[model samples]
Target: QGRGRRRRRVAPLAVSPPPASERGEEPLLRGIFEIGKRSCDVVLSARRLRWSPIVPESPAGGTGREEIIEMKDVFSVKLKRRRFVGQKKGGTLLGITIFKCLHKEENKLTDCAVHLNNLSEDHCNSWFRHLKEILNGFQNRPKSLKVFVNPSSHKREATHVYYEKVAPLFKLADIKTDIIRIFIDFVFCVGGDGSVSEVAHGLLLKAQIDAGKGTDYIPAPVRASVPLGVIPAGEAKQYCYILSVICFKSLWHIL
Candidate 1:
């Protein structure tokens, strides 16, 4: 067997893509930046820039959407967006401004900007690193969300409301919130508290946790306190009463 042993054949070396550091790839930047009293999560990636408002704690839905800046159409970063400077009060001022003109409608001009009022010096390095990485080329990290739609809740046309209200925002943010047993980010509960409570129980894996326990009732899991939201449908007890009185104003602003 030793005398008949065949010589080892070497495999040809194949080229691989360059390392992120070597390729001069940019790191994606994400953090809060403010405009007046409102604050938003600003994301800077190689291909695009976007900012989404920080939603407040409320059962009331937020209208905050991540607005994207198309790189192909972006001719220039206005002076305010070119360089982030220091503030007299304290901290760094990182700003992002965009002017959009649609391809189909070239004459249209829309301008908007958001500034980081006072980012702490301690956190500046990371932000600057992200900005540098974005300048080079940064890979996008997709977001995971849990979207719940209650079609049978309010009117017969409630599903239409969900498409009009929630889906577009998710699309803009490039988040996929497909149904799954477990969820990563916020759980948008569109119905009442009872269903939300049950969903929380399942998300916490209570059935497995409570298995083999002698107790008839499984106590609520401590980690079941996921961030949940319940929007009032006219069919529900609350918003129906409130909205009916408010003359049923269009809900476009809330979501």
Candidate 2:
């Protein structure tokens, strides 16, 4: 050949939608906000996210067939980049470095050996920049948040672990709370399917009481029919498997 031409190969851009496992049975964007003592994770669907608080009982009265109850409609909001950054730091850092930075950046940075040792100076600086962005964004976000907890499901120590390990991250995310009382948008049980049933029952009772007074006691859009989230804390979390509850083990992968 007298003349030859070479072709350049172009790399394809890869764009991925949120995993079905995280998005659940429906395709919707979810926003997770930390509300002080509690964390609220909201999921929005195209129409509305419906939750049934009660299931009708069987005629025999031995067991009741669960009936779906409609909860509320919500507009999906994508999880902010900062929230994701906070999650990443929570997994890596020991405590709320960002908040500590707000008050005493120098002291906090010096004390956090675990985080410092693991992360390089460049990484740490980048994280702080990301945290600043997140803090700026939180100013315009909603103040209230929903909380879900499974008191009876996890081992006795699990709660302590959550307090020590997880709670600080929420603080870092700039989640605020009342002085004495904590207002949770929604509280959920973290156990087997039975635990979910128990939570649903409790929520239904609360809803009935609120309805009697003609006041919305639970303000979160998902009040009585709050969305359920779970982490495998018990010996056998069979329900978690069915519902596709995100587990701690899988968190690293998803986030």
Candidate 3:
């Protein structure tokens, strides 16, 4: 018999475990609930909500699939109910509804709701209060917003876009909003360069006036009291260089 060639031996690659925050954190609450049509075992941690389908006992004993949603993405939580038309006094408690922002393709975000169905009102109420407290603890997220949309921008599609896409998400998130004719200290504009410049200029002028400085012969303009956010809804070809620089800075800040 010919001698077999020596087989090369390779060690298995080591896979790192998830971080302590993700893997080792203790759950705040655990319960049994129906998600969609399947019964599931649900768990809530400080930073995540997890649900796993409850599998029946089997000789082969396998783990059911688990789904997780980050708490940061959750915006609102409410007690779900079922009521007949014109019967608003009290409705049957169905379960809990959680509204969250879900990441979609191409870096877009969509509002979504998850219903945890349970017959017991007390159980749902406990979960609802815990979720509400968790949501309220996110201080970085805004509770209310003042929105100003330029109706003439993007072939007059800006208003439609706001109402159809943006407003719905805000509403679902339970974020109080003022669709301003004009409002707020920290203003934002949803239009092209002209709209941005107009808003920025007005803020600067207001800053100068507040500081008792004359507009005609101002050596140094006062800094704007509040920040301005720009949402590009129109083309800015001529100002592309400046916008790109600003965008780069914004991205840097975000990162």
TM-scores for all candidates: the values are: 0.29, 0.21, 0.60
| Model 2 lDDT tens row, 27-145 | 24333222232233333343232222122253542322222211111111112223354365334332212122122464542111111121234434443454344334444555545
Q: Which wins on lDDT, candidate 1 or candidate 2?
A: 1
Q: For residues 1-255, write the lDDT of model 3, one tens digit per residue.
A: 557978789989999987875773578899999998888999998789999888878455433899999998888787888999998767999898888888897888877889999999789888888888888888898989999986644445678989998897787778999985432444656677888788888888877876778989878888976666665777873443467666455445544
CA lDDT of 13 in candidate 1? 97
lDDT of 3: 0.79
RMSD of each: 22.2, 27.8, 16.6
Per-candidate total of colliding backbone pairs: 2, 7, 0
TM-score order of candidates, top first: 3, 1, 2
Predictions in order: lDDT? 0.50, 0.40, 0.79
Whole-model alpha-carbon lDDT for candidate 1: 0.50
Question: What lDDT, from 0 to 1, does candidate 2 have?
Answer: 0.40
On TM-score, the candidate that comes out on top is 3
